[model samples]
Target: GFCSQSWTGLIAQLCSGISIVCWLCALTPQIYLNWRSGNTESLSLSFILIWLSGDICNLLGCFLTNQLPFQKFLGIYFCTFDSMLCFQLFYYRWWVKRRDSQLLRSMGFSDTSYHHHLAPSSSSPDGQPQAGTALLAANYNNPTAPDFFEGPAASGANDAFSLLDPSSASSDSPIIGRIIAWVCCGFYITSRLPQILKNHRRRSVEGLSLSMFIFALNGNLFYFSSIMLQSFVSPPGLLLASLPYIIGSVGTVLQDFTVFSQWFVFRR
Candidate 1:
């Protein structure tokens, strides 16, 4: 029912619906993994924050452009989940570390010894520390511990993700919507780099979930398909409005594949 009577329209709607489901399910695996292990060090805090910012912008763009009801709903849905993800990152990064520090104190360990005691052994059977292990070991000697002991740290990395912001404004000038859409694209496109770099740096994807990226890839593919279909037969402005979503959906696919390849490559 996304369109009037054409088969393409029907298919487009179906694709869009599938995309919604895929994205809804995407974050669950990552969230579950973090919860199960009680660790979020494998995930880059910047990635989540940047993605959340994109979702927020997408939501605002949706409202400004007066997009379809479902489009608006999708924007809101993305924003809510991204926010939850941000909370999850903070929970593991701050709360869990605080709890561990408290437990260490109870065990009669002083601040100076906390890092030394908790730091994982560098010499794994594989001859290299796993990502989580490396994260803790690297800062063992420092008075200011990183990763496991401290709050989120900044990193220089680039990555990509997608958050659709439909601009269907016939009343308001579409210029603002277009600009917002580009900004969303920028965020979505670069959101994955930090995680990618983290995986590479740690040389492992432990504490991460492959299912999350898989679902995200599927969602982006379907999202692109749906928007492309809808734009094909629509007016010029509609196509123009849909262009950002298209780019947002397709632009990050290569990055998703890169992550996918990493999942296999680093499985050793």
Candidate 2:
């Protein structure tokens, strides 16, 4: 029994270590995708905001609950990374909008004027469309016309995933942030719902990064395993304490799976 317990403890610790490493790198795939595509429309701002809120809460909760020093550090790390992702979203949104506006301007088109200019007109005497009109008309008639000129204005995923720490509330903790932290926990749990629904509604997952979610899924699985193993190896009371974290990780995994399914089912 003693040897088995020790082995289990070791395995848990190993899982936890791997999870920590994963957390450190989890956002890389998504970041790369956003950078490569030069778009963040497929990502949900609400999802990012919710994840940020959760990270803030998790950080505060760590300090409030006096969790392990490493956990506190992890919270901080998560916040920093989450902030980068948020900034990426902001940057990409602004950049894409600006670029699209420039494209429209270069094309001598405005939102109001585009329809008017591109509308089909009677053919010229040569039985061909006018010089400038032909190209624009062809582009306008093409299925991908809107995508080229307008960009993916409506292609973001509407959900996000974040880890939550429930043990943040404590008698000694400040009331304000703690309350916010609790709210963050709720946000983290439900953040993925919108994205899933968005994918279902659109019947597409064009803007999402499969690698990002895959990394997230692996990270969460390991995180949950570590927590559950620790709880098992520790005293009975520890299990109850770890419940919230477990739920957070598990919920994230489920949502990730849902998103993955959408990717599989809706791939173009």
- Output the number of the TM-score-best candidate: 1
Clashing pairs in 1: 158-193, 159-189, 159-190, 159-191, 159-192, 159-193, 160-189, 160-192, 161-188
lDDT (tens digit, per residue) of candidate 1 on 1-268: 5345377766766765666667667777777776666666667887777777776776676566554455566566666666666677777666766777778789998855665544433344322323322111010000010010111100100010111223233534356565776787787777787777877776777677777777777777776676566555445455454555556656677778887788888785
Off by over 4 Å in 2: 66-69, 99-107, 113-184
lDDT for model 2: 0.51
Please state the error at residue 67 of candidate 1 in Å.
Answer: 3.6
TM-scores, each model vs. reference: 0.76, 0.70
Q: Write the per-residue lDDT of candidate 2 for residues 1-268, one digit (tens) a residue.
A: 9898888778776765565555566667777766676656556676676676666665665555555455556667667767777777777666545565568889877855643443223332222111212100000000000011111100010001111223434544434333543455465567777667656665666556676676666766776665566555565654443444455666777777788787877763
Candidate 1 segments whose C-alpha is farther than 4 A from its true place: 1-5, 117-170, 236-238
lDDT value, residue 244 of candidate 1: 53
Residue 247, candidate 2: Cα error in Å is 1.5
